[model samples]
Target: LLGVGVAQLADYTQEDLFAQALREEAAEQEQALEETEAEEEPEAVVVRRWLPGQDVRHAEFGPGWVQGSGVGRVTVRFETPWSEPGRVRTFAVDDPALEPARPLPLRRGEGMDGEGE
Candidate 1:
């Protein structure tokens, strides 16, 4: 009788372990499915209409002038008092840090220096 009881307990233990494994596998599969769905979701796209000579401000670079634009990029000529030639940097049109700015008065030798143009 004692042997039979032990055998029953062992069978129950094996069954419990199997059920737990199935639960873990199902949880993994569900998480994988959620990840796949997230990947399939379309991302929001922002369309920018930047033109040549457009005034823009950069969060870190200060005032800039839009030189040109391509599919997803914009070339900007930024004003840098530290450098006589100034600096030109390219950035994505959809950059959150770039925004329209009031036009700045052009200095005497601003864009005509031919050094940084």
Candidate 2:
């Protein structure tokens, strides 16, 4: 009877050790996966200060004018012929696609009125 009890005890110890080993392996794997995902994540986009009346361009939306700006967002009016006139779109200030548009140079005969002599 005592021998049988010892055998059962030994079996339980082995099972406990195996379970602990599996738990440790699973924890290690989870940590490695988290590290890999962190490496794969894209860098944060740098937000630029945008003010009202500023001209900006977007990669997909084309040219737009800044109508207003708030804490973390900027409101823009894009010239989309297919959409309603004066339609405004709001985007995150840190959007990587939005950039300041270069001003066009005016010719000698052309003024702010765009009238050529």
Give the alpha carbon lDDT tens digit for every residue of 32-114 in model 1: 99999989999756598899988888888877789899989999998743446668999998998998876654554555433
lDDT of 2 by residue, 1-117 (tens): 654557658988999999999999999999999999989999765568998978787887776779899989999998532335666889999888998875423343333333111
Candidate 2: misplaced stretches above 4 Å?
1-46, 80-84, 104-117
Indicate the worst ten consecutive residues by lDDT in candidate 1: 108-117
TM-score of each model, paired residue for residue? 0.48, 0.44
Residue 26 in model 1: lDDT:
100
Candidates' C-alpha lDDT: 0.80, 0.76
| Top TM-score hit | 1
Q: Kindly report the root-mean-square deviation of model 2 from the true structure over all alpha carbons.
A: 13.5
Cα RMSD of all models vs. native, in order, equals: 12.2, 13.5
Point out the worst 10-residue segment of candidate 2 by lDDT.
108-117
Which candidate should be chosen as best, given lDDT against the real structure?
1
